[model samples]
Target: MLKLVVCVKAVPDPEKADRIKIDPVTKNLIRQDIPMVLNPIDKFALEAALVLKEEKGAHITVISMGPPDAASIVKECMALGADKGILLSDRAFGGADAFATAFTLASGIKKLEEFDVVFCGMASSDGATEWVGPQIANFLDTPVVTMVKAIEENEDLTWTVRADFDNGYRRVKVQLPCVFTVTRDLNTPRTLSFSGIIKARKKQVDILGLEQLGVDPEKVGAKGSPTIVSDMEITSNTRETTMIQGTLEEKADAVLELLKDFGSIG
Candidate 1:
């Protein structure tokens, strides 16, 4: 049977972050009391995996990298039909950007390298950068296709996919053991059935620390990270203030005059 590994993330609820207070010296988000939930996009990723499993007799596994609380999200994935869960947790794994996180995840996935496909959401809600899937693909030397909306055919080692891209959609074929980042429109996430919920409670999750993975601390987390947030500020400049309200003729005339004076319609 083919193994499908779905990568999921536990993200902070945007509203939970509304109560954050930054430290003057550290400038890190005060996440002590902030509540988090499983990221919505990853739900689509898991759903796609489940649909494939139900149709093709595949074994599905879910993995995540975060603190201990992240295990909760993995359990949720199990409740949705994932056969196994793995949590990549360690203090050394903290403060990872998309690249570092992907590297660590790729390393962890390598430990269980029997999977035939890797699945993930296009991006995390917290950091909408959407760089991890490609980064992991680079680390694993596997082909990657992002923002996929449909999976037409998946062979033991090949995939024909339709990705929603700029201007329109694009069709691409990729080899297997590859990474895929999905958009929400890919499928409607099925509700957790009662049987799935019970099975989830009985599923075994393999938790691996940095040491168990046999990797150096300096090579896994913040120390291994290549990117960091230097500055984050909200700017207020883009707005539409010149509202013109009138009939069609008057509005057209006004627009023409304004464009001519502004050197646009001369």
Candidate 2:
């Protein structure tokens, strides 16, 4: 049997994007009342793991790092078919940038039994930096393939996959114990079912904190992060509407003149 790990995130609801705000002092998202949901693209990554479990009888462990509420998303993954869920939650783990976040997650992963494969979304909707997956692989000292669209073969210790490239896609054969940051093209995610929810209720979600992982607190949050937002400003967009008065031909000429004045046309 294979052991697989899928990394998931609880991001602020994208539908409520307008309500999102940034903290001027911390340079972090102010998510006081915002509802959090599983990162959309991460569903594809979890789906990939679920498919592998169904085909080859593997155990899938879904892991994430966030506040205590993030366990809700972890349970959602269990309802969707993951075998186990783990959430790394602690106030010390707050305000983590991509590098710090990945480091913390990698430390948590090291506590698990040796895993054969690690899957993650190509990027998170909130940050969209597309760096965590690769950085996790770097910390794990494993080969990484990003933007994976399909898994052509997953037999024995070698697997073949198709990944997005510069303009097209490339096929790659990778060894086991590798990391794959998947794209939505990989597979369609399954929805929750009543039976799955019941099963999830029986399964426990292990919550680990910075001390549990035995990682340096200074290396797992804002203080450990190398990148800092020195300044941020919100720019307002205002549009001016002008009414054209005259015959149809005159209106057309007027619009053309306005376009030229705005540099929208030559």
Candidate 3:
């Protein structure tokens, strides 16, 4: 049977307006009181894995790296039809930038040693760096095709993938055992079905700490991160605003005047 590994991340739902809250000291994401949800783009990655599973009888495994609470995410993946799910959690793994996260994920993937294909989201909602998947592929010495919108396996086990580029799609063919970061256009991710949700409780999610996976402390966290987020600040709409209560034509004229003042239009 074909074996596939899909990497997913839990992110604070950012769909809410002005919902981002950062930690004062660390300048990092404040998770203490936030409701975390799976990264939006990861739904596409999971759906792609599920499609491949249905078409080829593949064994899909979902893996993530985060805190112990991440166990809940693994069960959610199981509910989505993944055969296995794992959480790579440990204190030493905290504060991991995308590089460190990729390194640790590479270690965990190395341990699995069985996936015929690997999938990842285009990027995390919080970080948006879009670096981990290709970096992990570099570490694993596997070819990576990213921003994939559609994928199919050929008779020779080569994956034909289409990626959105400048104004069109780019077609790529990669041999099996490669990696890809899927785009949101892949498929619509179904929520938990009754039977799947019931079966999820019975499905066992394998949780592994850093030590359990032999992840080197010097190569898997802050110590291994090469780049630091020196600073981040919330965007402020501090510009002055004037209320213009008027009809559609008046509003359009007012908007045109404002644009002229800003040198956007003359």
Q: Highest lDDT, which number?
A: 2
Candidate models: Cα lDDT each = 0.86, 0.93, 0.86
Question: Candidate 1 clashing pairs?
Answer: none
> Which pairs clash in the backbone of model 2?
none
**Local accuracy of candidate 2 as per-residue lDDT tens digits, 79-195:** 999989999999998888999999998998899889999999999989888999999999999999999999999877999999999989999999989999999899999999999
The runs of at least 3 residues in candidate 2 whose Cα sits more than 4 Å from the true structure, single-residue gaps closed, are 235-266
How far does residue 18 in candidate 1 sit from its true spot (Å)? 3.0
Give the Cα RMSD of candidate 1: 2.5
Clashes of each: 0, 0, 0
lDDT of 3 by residue, 1-266 (tens): 88889999988777752666777776677776667788888988998889878876788889999988878877898998999998999889888999999999988888885778889999998888999999989988899998998875445678788987878999999987889998888889888899999999999878888779886788877788888877876688898878877999999999899889989986
Cα lDDT tens digits for candidate 1, 216-256:
78777779877777777778899766777799999898889
Off by over 4 Å in 1: 15-17, 20-28, 237-266
